[model samples]
Target: MAGIYIHIPFCKQACLYCNFHFSTNKKLIPQLVNAIAKEAFLRQDYLTETIETIYFGGGTPSILPTSDIVFLIDEIKKIFEVNSNTEITLEANPDDIDEANLVAWKKAGINRFSLGIQSFIDAELQWMNRSHNAKQAKHCIDLIKKYFTNYSIDLIFGSQLLSNEDWLVNIKTALSFNPPHLSCYALTIEEKTVLGNKVSKKVISNIDNEKQAQQFNILMKELAIAGFHHYEISNYAQPNFESKHNSSYWQSKHYLGLGPSAHSFNGSTRSWNIANNALYIQSIENNNLQIETEELTTTQQLNEYIMIALRTSGGINLNIIEERFGVTILLELKNKITAWLQANHIEQKNNFIQLTNLGKLYADGIAADLFF
Candidate 1:
């Protein structure tokens, strides 16, 4: 029903395309881990429901020692009610995956892994400045498969380095490993990232939208042919293998986020920890966790739901909308979606208005059109 997200804000190296809140300072690891555990205990009442998932995300969670990982999980269990079969996931990069670490992680209560194997091509991996090589990427999957059954691979498409043929090779290589789930994201250039800077200075070209769209289509078709469900816009999974933690966000389930730059959501409000690691640790150690909070208006919540629900295969549930926001609002939503329905971008399934495969390409634009 709910989840907990712990942000580990340290990485072995900085990737060229990343703009996330993280540090190359490994010295902060011990302090940050202890601070995160304390933060979890302090915010124990944020989610009232039983915890279905616990996700360790960040710059790279696998950078932690196995003992630290165990201590954190034990700390969380002491303060919260975790599900017996909870999906405790650690986001890892391939370079950090070795037999010893994998064995230790399994014993440390990490039942799932979301591997950051962005590409299986050495050239592309180098282009992204990834810490792992293509060989490590393949080897890690084989290692993880020996331990966890409910694991996911993270892949990136729409890179200028990836041609349609190269994208197919990446997909096929991942599928060959039979990972239960795959999350394929389009490479977005943020102004603060190294790649973004290059583009700003005209040192390199940006991603071509037409090429990106073509690769996405190829991704969908290939995944579907391989019997993976297009459950969310960026996610594909075999049956019953969808990510529980990420799904909770789309379903608007309450969760507690710990550590720097992590965000938490209750039904009506959103709060986020400060992005600066030093400041976050300092504040938490002082027994005052600093975060910016915002209370959502009814219209804001409705629009948020519209945006999230439309991206999902379940689409918008007319019944839930009516129940929560009133019948009048639901009727207006229906009226707003009439054009999309007529254009065959979206279709109705009983009370659900979901995107057609074609509509998935324009998911954001369509969701904006239906916004309150």
Candidate 2:
């Protein structure tokens, strides 16, 4: 099964740590939406299998009017074959979620929501420059619980302003809501963002990797004790609540992404649209989408598989690697795994190479070492 991702490249306000492609100018909303719809029709054949998920992700899909959202969904349906049980998720912010908006989104076929709650502390929210306050965050969760059953809450950990006590409170607040899923990410100061600029100018302290590691450990321990599956490195779910769309990506399934800065991937090829919103719209209007495409080399594919699978709970399936790449390559991988196994960084069971709790902290490095 495949998935479709529609990027809505507009937000009401810019967050300090955000480096996503979006414009605060609301005037381009109409043109952007229309261009996205056209893009859907243009790239309809990118996925050969049935579409199992359609994710409305972006700068902030929650800011779109209900009618516009409905129009885009309808347009996608008209052009593509969506599965009956497809999961349609909309990434929403706390401030945009109200009773009326929730009802409207449900009517527009958004069965799932990935709410950006960030933090429950007012000071933390202010520091991040999120548009919603702490009160709005709580209210949005309450409203979502009342209206929807399948939703995920996003939280950020490892900020300099957040103490251990504050981090505990954030987790406790999320647990109080009993959300089906939670995605926690450590704050990374990407270059060109406000937070990055502040750090460069010494106006704000940089993120502490040790503190971040501590918080990550705290998260894994608490969430596991709470009976949530640490399904992926940055994602947690209760039972069968894992995100299908994202899971498809990890499984190397084909997906088509529409809109500015969106990436599309088939098994052998990958492509992405230009990041500039105005340029994207103009190019599409001119009947020429400025996209860059690349065919994946065998080594690139093997490296990608290693990177994504290592971050997952199931780890890397040795048999699949052997089958796809070759037994020689698998043997080479096994030698590397043997070293890690001796170091207590990895465990081999039933031909799968899974990470140990301690090893997870250095997952990226281990994956890179194993890459051919």
lDDT of each: 0.93, 0.93
- How far in Å is the alpha carbon of 347 misplaced in model 2? 1.2
lDDT of 1 by residue, 249-298 (tens): 99999988999999999888999999999899899999998999999999
Clashes of 1: 0
Q: In model 1, which regions exceed 4 Å deviation?
A: none
Backbone clashes in model 1, listed as residue pairs = none
Give the Cα error of residue 296 in candidate 2, in Å.
0.5
The 10 consecutive residues of candidate 1 with the worst lDDT sum are 40-49
| TM-scores of the models, in the order given | 0.98, 0.98
Superposed Cα deviation of residue 186, candidate 2 (Å): 1.1
Q: How far off is residue 205 in model 2, in Å?
A: 1.3
